[model samples]
Target: MRSTLRSSPQSTPAFSLIEVLIGVLILALGLLGLAAVFPVVVRQQRTAADQTQGLIVARNAEAYLRGHTLTTTRSVPNASVPGGGLLAPSDPIPEQNRRGLDILRYQGVTATNPYSTWSFNAANPDRPGPWEIPTYSLVYTNPDRGNMLVAATNQTAGVQFAQRDRLWPAAYSSVDTRVDDNKYANEPRYIWDVATRRVDPGTPSNVGDDGIQFAVFVRRIDSSIRVSRRDLINDPNDPLRLSRPTRDLRLADVLTGDRLGLGGVVTLQRAEHRVAVAVTNNSNSPVPTLNGEGEYAMPMRMQIEAIDDPDGQGLSRFLLPSSATDIQRRLLREPGQKFVDNLGNIYTVVKATFDKNPPNTSNPPEVQPENERRSILVSPAASANAAALAASGDLQVVFTPQVPAAVHVFTMEPR
Candidate 1:
């Protein structure tokens, strides 16, 4: 009887095939849900990485800009070129792209042109809308940066005299017998003549003919000089300044002192407080040579500093102090002050000096209507009465591009 009961109970112990299939189906559904969400998660992570990379690139660029001073001209040295120290890339991209940095330049003080504008959505040359145009110069050794050639005269003969080998016969007389031909007589004359190979001395050195003839020849030695603004602008061979403007304008005339809160007055003594451009040559080629033409590299630290009034007075009489008195009390009350912006927005100043015209008088006589009498007089410290002031005086605008530590990136877009 026990064995029969045990066998009957065992028959109901195992799960049905349908139940097993249902369990498998539940497990499969969970896996399917996980699979569907996996791609979205991965995409999100990739997007985050791209954004981080972009920010890093921008920051690096800014840092570079801030560290360097602003200059009318820039030079990217051949030595700065990566890999090929002597050859610069024809285009700024690929080299800059791989580095995650993009460069843009402007010819004038203000970047008003579309080509000179910087944007993140600029397209490639072949693409539409967003486009980037980066400039690069061919790499060459700069002879101006102390890499110069000097002609050292050595007296190889017993009675050696200095004789300059003139490249331009017209500038130097071949038959001039009165010139002293001694060791120091014609020893490569002026520095310009030696470096430029120009024989034009404008004046000739001559003494009574005294059979004191010396043989002088030029020998190239290395030296260098700092690049100058005129050199970059006047050099026809330089690609960067080939189209630079030749017009002359004083710095004071170009910048409005009033806008900078400098009282519309310019003084030479205050020149130190004014902003001045600093030029740097990153090019491998030195100044006075056309090899680095059209190559200007901007540093991150370039900035402009001008005068600014912290009290917000000193520009124009339009910004002045006003008084609102309690007529019944006969006591000087709150004075009104207003600051106007370029957009015609008026801001009220809470506290100001209050003065009574009729001292000790209980009731000061009213001159005109309250609206008309309330004159927005300019303070003595205010600069100009012009609608908009040029960015000038104690004010400083530092253009420090944010560059990232790990990467370089250039992005351009429409304004």
Candidate 2:
């Protein structure tokens, strides 16, 4: 009792069980909140990296363009090349000199053979129009093959860039190397394309003849997606016109499965969509009468459809599908994304519209579809070309690789 009395003050009470649990709960809640931010941080980092790389690539392209001097005279197409007629011999779009800016015209526009030329947009008169193919003489003469050339195997069917549209970060051949020691091999952070158009008036007074003002369009390369190109057939619903698939193309099923859907028919009932393609040399070309493979580069050659706007806004909308096969679901989610169509039309995605979900339940589960209808609105509305193609009786089943990617424009005087 004397010793207890000697203890001046009672010692502070120990923490109870409830206090410990509460402390743990608070810590866990904070950790969970922190964990949720990690993915967002990662995405932001990736986006920033992409943008940085894009700018660097664009600058490199500008340097390349500036280093090369433009040929003033008209270049005649060589008769030696079999498809020489389709190729542009010189720089079709002019710079300071108005005389050089001439549009190339061909006899016909076929599905298998889409033509490219210089196009003007009233909406943005200061910048250049869309790009289909680059000028021949300028790219061919350049010595930098490592960064400028796209692998021949990667070329889009029916549509070939002047030489190779893609500009790789590393050597083109090392894109998929198997060297164990070379961990960095084939891991390109970014790939890009370059197109040019005149900016200022073609006048030597403003910008010297040699110092012509030009706009360089540098677009990022996203993905190389392959889809089947069905033969153009008569639309039963509209006898006069060729058929556009009433239902969305079952891209994922056809690609991932063993057999392709039968008769190229758009079926309401979901079935096994597989096309077992057998090739001798592993050629990537579309198979004849089988699941033909058409490679489309994201933001470059990725296909997007023109949406029907009831309000007469002249908006070009991309129909986004809930299906996993529809690449739009993952890519092209942001506005201001730029892409050039096969018709040499450049479009900037504006905003995403409402997502239409499919029926969740049905009497027969097998009959129930998993995809929903989604639409993305784009600006500089589609020209009459899309409608004309759909109406054209010729093989209209051609897959237009509409590439929409990050684009950087540079205004510089070519040296």
Candidate 3:
């Protein structure tokens, strides 16, 4: 056959060594580009997911604040702490308890300090900060939420709350001044430190809560605004009452350019709106009826309500303390009386005290354009007009029989 098959077509020409190397180099470059692209793609994807979740969390918090806490009617002050009272950086609805949310509110209402938010206690009831303080709230048990103590600090493993035992003597140091003085003296310690993610050894958690554990961090990224104690207090009667800034306090502007608006940081605006859900249990109380707010915790205090009017008029109110001295006289002063609410739940009356105003003291002389003596509902700061009004007896007292008492309509378990 034409042995000229050309000897098997002379074996296909072998690729040159340089040509092969170039081909390999091209393939390697393609793979390198893909590898680089993968990380970027992953990062972008993660950011998008975080942002979406954040929006939901933020809105939920906003709704909760509006629903539970009352927003102070603000009137941007013209001067720094205009009334010269106990100034706080934030609007101190209760400078002493603005967001304290401690059940102690009901306890001390009839004491020397009519209300904690109105008074400052050096030994007990540690005041947190010009931060969001809870005055009223209801906590319910939700086992579905797992250990959240770890989540508060963004850690994989959480600190054992029970191991820490919130006893003030155990966890605190004599020289510890950064926290409230009553750091861990109470039971059911609730106030948690974000930096340490540990319960404040001095504050009360719920009546029987093992401890507070949350999945979301009370994420804050703003620099601390050293708010004046005078600024935070409210002087309802002071014509020159200092008010909050008309505009919102922004994190980026207050602290660094890098702020919570960016994905990796935390920030704080105020307490009313929470960015996360906070829960704890053992009380097994029913979830309070929430408003159109989001699924978030209200700045709440662990409160105990008494329904029995020892006077029987149903108008007799009680303000009992849980302090050492108060406990000794608990049965004598705050006699227990069984009561049933609309829900048919029974609660034992804890204390009974007069709802009448305390006796007026020899008014202290004015200091720095304001009164130095601040009572339970009294603000130290005042305006010239406030003084004139007080003198004329035209100044309206925040507390009076006119203001209706806050009695739980439904029945709740008594502490």
Candidate 4:
């Protein structure tokens, strides 16, 4: 065999400098593309997150308002409390830790920025001439006790004796002036001054003398009121119902009555009584009574009752019939009312029976001969007598939102 010089195949030369540069250039371009896309992705994610957070805050606020009934006492415009606005009467109750309403005073909404508002020292000694934001005068009273009839003194015998003594008078007597003079002298005066920006001297300045008194109380929506008519009808004794059956089927049937359409009557049985109560509108208006066929009256009692689920599933449901519409229109449909905040956020009130009956029960249960049912919508407007209730600070009720940071506060005056 010829030992041919088998020269090993020489290995190819390594890549040229130009080739190396090209490869690096390609890699750099790819890296640049990735860098460009990263910021866009991050921005989109951040925007989505912000929108979701804002939506959550809004929905939480709406649910909170719907879950509990609102009254002038607690929902006072620009009311203040320890955390912010006026504190609800139930604020002191331990059980209301999570369920109480928060009066969210909306400062304003910023598209891509944090929200801010004018601030002042409520207790600042140096700031002169009352804080810019008017302070509220809240007078709370016992509607039952303050307005109850009392034996008149011998001086006024012919007239039926009336309990002229107010449990929570809106203003302080000259002898009992505690807050500054410019401040509301009484609960009623305070609320009136704050709401209407006008001072009012309540009628009959003397104690034990009939005069306007106002009070407001705040209470959570008791679990009993949370149940729907169907649920209550099915299981009247459900612990969630928060009511009792004092009598047999006859009494139960009579109390519930045929108008309700449920075979058995569900008796709330003073459930309203057990609710945390507060009063507002203690200031005495020159008119004395807020008149409008008793409709659209302030200091109205807000009662909430779960209705028979239209879907028949025994659960409460809110439906939007219109698909292409704004939130305000949806919330203001028939059987519903719209409540807009200062920021123009709209809320709706769905129509439902507050009690087993279509209408509310007379305040004094005994006053009605057969416990007549009344519709809250159709019931007489808040009585002018409510002015007295307001003066005592008994008519104002405070509604505090659960999330303090998200609520907007503003005033809604009578139209």
Candidate 5:
């Protein structure tokens, strides 16, 4: 064979070094373009999902409203109100937790929020101790002591005892809703008091409805009421029980600490006593009757809070609209509540007022955002009460988007 320089195929240059480099560059550019489009695709998907959730929530709210007849929405007329409502007395026990003052005060001004007012024990005729309470007061009896009546001294419904005669003609007389600041160790969560501009703001004025029902006339034993003690110089029940303040616990000394640290110092070992209680308006009676008309009956008010979810994930601020007032806005922006997600997604709330005047006669009970906050009345008479426990008519309790109209709003974060 002629020894020609038969170059093997592998020896030939398949591509120059520049060509290889260019190929890599093109591939990299294509990958970069894909990466850029990835974020856009994600953002669009997220937006669609969020908006769908918003509509879903709105319809859920609408269905809920429709299901409630004019009756079920009525609450106690004087719930959480000062100088309002009635109280149903227990059957009467002699050895009640009548430990405090004869001129005793319960969940009155000292312990209650602005929505609820406090009063002294109201009694006139026979003084049980030294003085009978003069104003309306809430009393708690020790269940261990046989559910005895620990109330203002001896009296029937007379001039001094005539609190129940005040009639509640209208079905829904009052809007029983109030706001309460969140607290830990008696310290308020935030400092800025937009509603009242309270300087200390330990417990300032409440703003929007907390979206929970409160009782006007609270009967039966409320398990939440109990007693707790704090260290006074030393733990009262210490091993040696060598508490200096406990031995000399005069009211003056215990209350003011006798200029000692025990004034504010209390035992942290809390003990629940049926006799000891911190009363709230929830335990008071708003509609008391000489007859048993309002027995075990508590007035309940509608709140614009989050709705119940089958999945247990509560509704976010889905109904909160841009038209919310300054106080309403602050209420919606509760601390630590996540409104937006990490992926530039947000969730919002859109709610309608139970008292909106001109109903959205159009489609799907759609009230204007402004009208959603207007206080309305529910005066269809208590005759309709509990009659429509189950929903009926074209008005159904829908939760999904099968309903054509929107009653709520949900929004995601803008990209």
Candidate 6:
């Protein structure tokens, strides 16, 4: 029997290989874009959180100053300063020695030199008897340290003894283990300083209506090494245990030679006991330092070097000391990095650039490109004639001894 060939049923249309690949490519691109955005979102969140915390700390400081008034006076031994002065049994009590006083009194309006030149303020007042030029004082806090704020010595205040009189979160007790624990070893601390100025020097008739202004500065402390504020208070020798030069240390010597090497936050004990984080992790991979015997050399940690900005941007450049090993040249480029001049003028790092392997352009290779100096541009751009200032023996912008995570300048009136 002749049976007609049955036609195959029409097959359902399916995606071709090329079309599937194209779809996958589109999906992958979208996923990659999301991956990139995640880190940015996380960073933004962290920054916002830090800013909120800073503002809170500042407000807290204002509350403390307004509520706690310093009335008692302390005597300083003249012999400790001015060397063998027959002047008085003790040095004259400093005017700023006291805090939380009414505006008229703190401003010294009745004194012979009303608005006496405060070293922290400008030499010449701008036309007013009372301008709020705040004098700063540093305070360190650690949650593990029994939630107390440790007041650091303020040589800027001129009356170091008065620091003890300032209001503290908790009363000092000889039996308190928390107070003593802060003296030994505590890593990862938070540092904030406060300064108060009389915003309104009330008239003699309305002296009670005066208002006080507070400026609070908060900095991030990324120190892995111990910071002993108590030692600074009590011990005469080896405070902070930073006597050992970090420049002498090798990769193997720090943090027990982690596989990541001496990267990330580095404790610059000699750099005013300030803690610093590396600009980037990629560049911090420790390069091996071989000894004469062809073995890995073990030395102390490398010390950071502060180089003047060749571009005349003030203290805007940094490098590793000549003794630096492979761990040198890690720039402190984190945004909002706060540095303070000797005069307590805070400078924030807005930008940073590091030439990992800059071209060496010297007749006989004067310096290696890898050793090129890095640049950091801070706000309040230093005078264009920074070199001239240095030559004139003026105070150049020096971020003495410490770099904190962030600096917040807050103007809070005492409530």
TM-scores across all candidates?
Answer: 0.22, 0.41, 0.23, 0.22, 0.22, 0.39
Minimum summed lDDT over a 10-residue window in model 2 is located at 94-103
Q: Model 3 over residues 1-415: C-alpha lDDT tens digits?
A: 4555554655868889999999999999999999999999997775464445434443443343223211111111212110001111111222111221111111112233222232223243332111122222322111122112211111222222221121112222232132342221221111122110011112232211111111111211111222112221142433333432222222121221111221233222333222112222102221222221122223211122222233433333333223213222222232322222111122334334342332333432322111111111111223344334334322221110010111111111111
Q: Report residue 324 deviation for candidate 2 (angstroms).
A: 14
- Give lDDT tens digits, candidate 2, residues 1-415: 4554444456756889999999999999999999999998997886677667666766775665444333121122221101111112223112211111111222222233222122233233333333333332332211211112221111121222222323445333332233453232543333344443333222212212222222234333323323344332333423422434332222332322211232343321113232122111112221222222222121112334334553468775555433324343433445555554433355666765543332454334334332333456767766666544323311011111222224554444433
Error of 4 at 225 (Å): 41
Model 2 steric clash total? 15
Top lDDT model: 2
lDDT of 4 by residue, 228-345 (tens): 1232423545443344322122211211221122233234433211211122121221111111111001221111222223333322322221221232222123242322211122
lDDT of 1 at 68: 26
Model 3 weakest lDDT span, ten residues long: 398-407
Per-residue lDDT, model 2, residue 13, is 64
> In TM-score terms, which candidate is top?
2
TM-score of predicted model 3? Answer: 0.23
Clashes of 5: 34
lDDT scores in order: 0.23, 0.35, 0.25, 0.25, 0.25, 0.33
Select the stronger candidate by lDDT from 4 and 6.
6
- Candidate 6 residues 1-415, lDDT tens each? 9989765656657789999999999999999999999999998897786677665655555565444332111112221111000001011111211111111112222233332222222343221122222212222221111122212122112222221122122112122223243331222223344333333333333332333333354444323433323222122343433542222222111212111112232332222221121111112342222111111111112222343554654445433344433343232344465543322345666655553333444523324443354445566654434333333333222221123434533333322
Off by over 4 Å in 3: 1-8, 11-13, 69-110, 113-129, 132-415
Clashes of each: 85, 15, 35, 79, 34, 9
Q: Model 4, residue 95: displacement in angstroms?
A: 28
**Better model by TM-score, 3 or 4?**
3
